[model samples]
Target: MAVRPDPIPAAQAAGTSLEEELAAVAASSLDQLRPRFRALFRVPVPDCLSRDMVARLIVHRLQEQRLGKLDRSLAEQVDRLGRGQESRRRFKAGTVLVREHDGVMHEVMVVPDGFLWNGGTFASLSIIAKRITGTSWNGPRFFGLRPVLKKHAPEAAVVVDDADA
Candidate 1:
């Protein structure tokens, strides 16, 4: 088995001050970046970035190292919102969401405005879901879809307690 060397170079790891670290990252070359990326992320660095991107990445890593890594949920939400894309989701307009209630099959069409169920256009899936079930329900959850998890939604933001605020 091949043993990996200490991820950070000895010079950088030897208690170098933050100012020195920032300067080093600013001056870093591709050759210098591989081990630094490994040291920080504990993973091999991907080769796809341009030289300029690596420098920008180094600055970002340095900030994280000094302050703290972003919260995992927050980071994921930012990543989702940043791309401005739905990334080819499995369902879209004209797709059908179906549910069975009390031996009856209910089909809902994915419309641009909302779901179409029982020949009526409703504003939200939840409303259609309730109409089908005769009870309040989370529309997406009722249809066997992956519920929009609180962490997955930036709009379902994390709220601190009044005391925490």
Candidate 2:
């Protein structure tokens, strides 16, 4: 008979710091992680998942337990962003966006007021994209921040002859 490892609650009884627990999880091997994963998740670790993935999931769960999970609205927003359902993309200050257009490389830095490009501050990415391409362009799409939308071709009309009917 094989011995079962202690669950996360029992493991936490050791009173280790969150960072220490996280580090331990990061250093643990696949075999070591399986029982911990089972204990924390209350389910068998899927065989299809790699060791790295299992470790990440375990870490996330630990963090959630230690420092509460995201609120419902914030979690929903994150899920929407991940699924590309959110239209507006927010960039933190100091973020740098780069794009290549017509053999020229353009770099834009996100600022508190707006965006900085070529020593000038602009209100939006569209303005920067227009300046670069000499045409109106969706800034996020131009800079590859957003996915390209494909235009569907119109369906052909089918005609039926009364004689055939």
**TM-score of every candidate:** 0.41, 0.49
Q: Which regions of candidate 1 fall more than 4 Å away from where they truly are?
A: 1-76, 79-90, 147-165
lDDT of 2 by residue, 50-92 (tens): 9899999999998999999999888988898899796466777
Which pairs of residues clash in candidate 2, taking residues 3 or more apart in a chain or in different chains?
none
Best by lDDT: 2
lDDT accuracy of residue 84 in candidate 2: 75
User: What's the CA error at residue 66 for candidate 2, in Å?
Assistant: 0.4
- Give the range of the ten consecutive residues with the poorest summed lDDT in model 2: 153-162
Kindly list the per-residue Cα lDDT of model 1 for residues 69-108, writing each as its tens digit.
Answer: 8898778767887887343233456776666676777777
The predictions' CA RMSDs to the true structure, in order, are: 14.1, 15.6
